[model samples]
Target: MEVFEPFLAGIDNPDHRDRVEEIFNWVKTRFPNLMPKIAWNQPMFTDHDTFIIGFSVAKQHMAVAPEEAGIHRFSEEIVQAGYDHTKELMRIRWDRPMDFALLERMIEFNLLDKQDCSTFWRK
Candidate 1:
């Protein structure tokens, strides 16, 4: 449960750790108000009290849940790039680090998307 513990724990390679940190820093620069938290034993980012994204380390890959509409928006590109796409997440092989450009775009889109907070109250 520490906010960044899982992220730090998941990194097995020093190079990957450095890359992840670089990407995290870039995201923080773009979304200064975003909060970092641990959820489901993974690293997550939130905004307006809603989880905007999450990342985990799998057996042979690193996975990121880009969240909501980001899933659909980046599905094709993810698949074309040889990454696996779940309903709301993408998993990239550790040997192949994430695409920083695509990740940045997805984060920006999620930050700008309007959320229906009322839905949270309804449920």
Candidate 2:
């Protein structure tokens, strides 16, 4: 969480900031093996330097980027979770509930899928 302090602090809305912090902490606690860092002005997690997941704050929602493959892999469930998405990111509206279970699955999938990857991003 310390790595994300400066970014979290920059959020003007305390509620939004706290919510993001809670999610970040949850990911850290659940997957302690994941390395946390700030990249492209966003908070991201990587395994062996390969991106597992990333997050960004938007005007009306927080976006979760598990990469295009993750998005296509879980498109059905993402809709069921009531979140909106594009090929690159899922948007969780500030007023809606977060599906942490879905999030965990996404991270796990990425960790395993990219376990042997040698680059920062999938090619």
Best model per TM-score: 2
**Candidate 2 residue-wise lDDT, 1-123, digit = tens:** 689999999999999999999999999999999999999889999999899999999879999999999999999999999999999999999999889999999999998899999999889
Give lDDT per model, in order: 0.73, 0.95
What is the TM-score (0 to 1) of candidate 1?
A: 0.78
Cα lDDT tens digits, model 1, 1-123, are: 245755786678877777666667777777788888776676777877776777776667778887647889889888878888888789888788668778877777776663654231113
Per-prediction TM-score, please?
Answer: 0.78, 0.98
Clashing pairs in 1: none
For model 2, give the RMSD to the true fold. 0.6
